[model samples]
Target: MATLMAVMVFGGAAALALYALAATVLPQASRIAAVLRGQSGNVRFEPLSSLVRAERRIAVRRWAAGSTMTAAALRPREAA
Candidate 1:
């Protein structure tokens, strides 16, 4: 009975994970693969220099316990 219960719990979790991936990533990944392919149908790999870039780094001691994020909002010209 324990083995059966464990299997049911993990299986449901795995199904939900796969569903999330299929919903979010699969469409964008297909477009990226198509863009990277060459005329001969092979994937033309790019060098790391082109793929990765350095961003402005912030020095942080530690992360806070919770996440609170902000988004850039648009207003009328006079608001700025």
Candidate 2:
């Protein structure tokens, strides 16, 4: 009976601790994974800097008219 009680207590405590940690971390983990996968829309991080930067370091420009824009415009506005 004592052994059974100890096992139950230990199991319950372990389960509770696991649940608490998951509840705290799962949302952040999912968000980070989503950002890494380029699936997040807003790219917002609460109470801190955004996961995505204001300016992208690399950009791919598509020419719909089969003509490229001037290098001045193609470069970032700040770079120009």
Candidate 3:
């Protein structure tokens, strides 16, 4: 029981420390991101729809190519 209590206390302290660290760091991260966005002339943050669409298209093409290759490999070859 004592060991379990000690573990709980230490784990709680560690979690609190991590929370404090993120609280201090996130604002700085956001500021840096805003600066980069400003320099790139993008006034607003856009959703990732276009990027996701492009990735899906690439993935579909790769799947089709792989399926074609596997089908060809499994086909019986004629003997000469």
Cα RMSD for candidates in order: 17.2, 13.8, 9.7
Give the Å error, residue 65, model 2: 55
List candidate 1 stretches off by more than 4 Å: 38-80
* Candidate 3 global CA lDDT score: 0.84
Model 2, CA-based lDDT = 0.69
Q: What is the C-alpha local distance difference test score of each model?
A: 0.62, 0.69, 0.84
Instruction: Output the worst ten-in-a-row residue range by lDDT, candidate 3.
Output: 38-47
lDDT of 2 by residue, 1-80 (tens): 99999999999999999999999888789777878998975645454333233222122223343265667766766545
- Cα lDDT tens digits, model 1, 1-80, are 99999999999999999999888988677666766783344456667645343221121212231233334333335645
Model 3, 1-80: lDDT tens digits are: 99999999999999999999999988778667878787544456556877898999999998898876876687899999
Steric clash pairs (candidate 3) = none
| TM-score-better candidate, 1 vs 3 | 1
Which runs in model 3 stand beyond 4 Å of their true positions?
30-80
Q: In model 2, which runs have C-alpha deviations exceeding 4 angstroms?
A: 34-80
What's the TM-score of each model vs. the native? Answer: 0.41, 0.41, 0.37
- In model 2, the worst 10-residue window by lDDT is 51-60
